[model samples]
Target: MKGKGKKLRKREKAMESGSVEDVLRIDVQNLIVSLNQDNDGVAEGENAAPELETENLPEPGTEIDVKVVELSSTGDGLALHEGSKRVYVVPFSIPGDTVKVKIFRHVLDESYSIADFISVVTPSELRDDSRIGCKYFGKCSGCQFQMMDYSEQLKHKKRIVEKAFRHFSQLPPELIPAIQDTIGSPLQYGYRTKLTPHFDGPPSWRKNREPFTSRPPIGFMLKGTHQTLDIEDCPIGTDVVRLGMKNERARMEVEYGNYTRGATILLRESTRRIPKNESRPSSSPKARSKSPSPLPPDNAAVKVETESYTDVKTCVTSNTATSTEYVGPYVFYNPAGSFFQNNNSILPVFTDYVRQHILPPPSSPSSSPSSSQPIKYLVDAYSGSGLFTITLSSLFSGGSVGIDISDASIKYATENAAANDLPLSRVRFIAADAKDLFTPAIRRAYPGDQTAVVIDPPRKGCDQDFLSQLLRFAPRRVVYVSCNVHTQARDIGVLVRGLEGEGSKGTRYSIESIRGFDFFPQTGHVEGVAVLNRVDE
Candidate 1:
């Protein structure tokens, strides 16, 4: 066996260096000889009947070469062997290709095995072209499908959503229309409005054994890894955000002398206080002794603050101060430490879509009774910083309510409302759990007469109790904004089923429309909004 292995290796090396004619000559002769041997072996075995080919069977953990025959629901490649029971799922692989894979994780109960591809035996047509602009495309892990063409990405995302809706809810195909893709951002690169870059103590600080030695490096966390990737320049971040990171890095190096390790440094684009400073120990003796470094007269950091006509003020901290004031405008606010959509140009379009669906055009007088009231109330549940509530407030003369669990968000929402001159009585901001706020008593306090509820829950979807209360409240319309489609479908299924139940007899809410927003382009993530309207009894 060892001699045969060495001979094979030598032959492979010779083949690599030999001309095409030479390789063909060898193959012809080898095939002729192999045919003769095969004929002889078949003749001998004919009389005894063919023995089972046990000798060639693979061991339990041994990997085998296979051609991907299909794609899994999650877009993984699936491969199978004709006579074998084992099946493999190759990540980042497409169907209609051959790949050499090694099984890494296997469970007998599961139908498919997870594998890591060793090499491509046959490449698929779906293999993506190399990216043109960004060098950090793959390594950054910020965008997975950037290499794929934009059209193809949209098609795949639509298919993913459709499949999730079909498989999870078993909804009729006609009930779910093809996902509507929003216009892709014009500035595909360098379009991010915000960025949070973190840093640890400087190298010199590490050498000095200073008080702060465990600070994280200043930059985005490495893709999938806990280690920080020092980001001196990030193409996706806005200019001001990038500059802020650079300034923060310089300040940390100058003041801390590189002593910190494992500490997180924050560089923010908004005039909103960069969160990193708040993270520092407020009462630490060391903090008291350390004074913030002063900026040079010409090098002062800019700050961008905006106040809406309704009295909602947004303070964004950066290098040069930029402010905008308007009434009946949308203001997006993400958690101080969480990711949020940041495209300013498309903010109006996105909000307009939500508003239209939440409050459709008023019914003609001929279609309804003379006393029918126009939609008046709007409830922006999970309203972070009051973007949805304040922006949509203009549509209703009656008023709106914004509810959230974050106190910081409530403070910002109230200030934002006040800044916009939306009378305090017209819009009330509540800092309470959405579930607690959606109870029977609370719903009664804010009568459902001509009410519309806009719910933008986290990825996990709303809690069961909250859903139940929401169904009981039975707003005239519901605008569900979801970041994850699978959970969205599940929650929608629950709502649909609840509407069919006894207590919900007169509260049926049909899914009027659904649309997909490519907020995080180049990545598989997408945001969707669904409109549901109550059926009059």
Candidate 2:
């Protein structure tokens, strides 16, 4: 394996020494073979670029025309200069959009540069040229796909997952299960359950404008810059969440002096915040609505909006029936800033999918052959606030235990467990570091022989120790959930292939299924869930 890898690297080096096009082609082909499958311009009559203290960047208004060939994993369109070996990342642009761009950031040694989308010289067919998209589409770093068809976004995301696995994982591509199409978000817009708009230093930029109000600008930050792009409303959030921002601003206006420094405020809406009797306007961009809701209650005020995502004091919420256990709703306390799913509408369906993969229905006599192991115990590692741990605990008779690094998360998880009326005998949560996520007692309770382990780690994926301990304690089945498919694929490789130096077995597990969940519509971010089972002894 080492010799083959060295030979592959040598071949890649040779290719790099050749034409840039050859290097790119080979790199792309390898991604498919491995598992695989696979800007610019500004010119003319365009709005002049914003002036700034020019540094080592291209002239503040310099226009460079280029053709966008593809999109980076982050969803930024990429234009390659084969002759110069230069790559430019143009945000809010899509593949096949030939455009002239105004370069904003350029560091020669970095081998690439950043540019703002100026004008589309020849638009891509995938481009949604409705011209009625988000007003802040490009300037605000919020939604990247306002001009992209949602279907195209899903296609690009599916390819992103493929590239992640092909480029990062250590296992053979043939061993990977079929990659499924990305599950689209039911509510593409107005689905965000949370909203956090912040302010920066005193309105220095706005001071020059005539009749400037003392009120600090409120909205999202400009793309790739710290400057705030104040707005009257945000289209992505629910009507309640967006309209409530005005009330928050009103409250902040009165208490503006209380804010001595820049801070991001929080406003979360429980999808259930609005009663069932009310109608939820369609999330389609075509049906984008700005209907207002009553002002948020006075208590919605945030105190000391500190850096740790302070204050859920006002806009607290509960999960809707569809997103949690059918028998009960899991109520999470959001004061401590624990993470939760953003797209509420699809969460229940998403969790249902997870449940489906984790538990294949009992094989009936007449049913097709499908292998399944009835799991007794469950370990929800990285179980922040115990969402999965508490919700899925009742399924396993031997009981379930959750582990998280944050004490706040564990505390809230404990409260949530009680709130959901989860039996203590069957549910538990532990706050521990990565190494201690699984302890002797937790292990003892679950006699690993018949256990199921579900993990949802951050984008970087699992660490070596977690992978080592996971394999060492060999659960009967594993359900790995990740938002970053690249890292998920990398961790999947480590799990399937085991450690590089410690060759204990040919393969420890086999992929049962893989699927993607589109959590953030109009953006590149995606969530993926994969299931695997241990090879029988």
**lDDT by candidate, in order shown:** 0.58, 0.66
Taking all chains together, the TM-score of candidate 1 against the true structure is 0.67
In the range 413-480, model 1's lDDT, one tens digit per residue, is 78767655677878889888866977665566566657889988887677666776677777777898
Compose the digit string of candidate 2's lDDT tens values, residues 1-537: 655444533433332221223223333333223221122333322113222222344564578777777777776777743333356678888878888898886644344567888888888888866833578887888878888878888988888777666656646679887789999988888777687888875554355333324667888989888889887788778665776687778876777665545777776653222223335422111222546334335455332233422222234433221121111244554442346776666877887777777754466121112224356888999988777886687788888888899887787677767766786788888888877666677778876666889999876677766876787677767999998776687677767764322332323677888878899988878898989877654
Which segments of model 2 are wrong by more than 4 Å? 1-61, 81-85, 107-111, 203-213, 271-330, 360-373, 500-507
Predictions: Cα RMSD each: 16.5, 11.1
TM-score for each model: 0.67, 0.75
In angstroms, how far off is 536's CA in candidate 2? 3.2
lDDT of 2 at 397: 89
Runs of candidate 1 exceeding 4 Å displacement = 1-104, 107-109, 113-128, 170-178, 196-233, 245-261, 271-340, 362-372, 439-442, 499-506
- Least lDDT summed over 10 consecutive residues: which range in candidate 2? 319-328
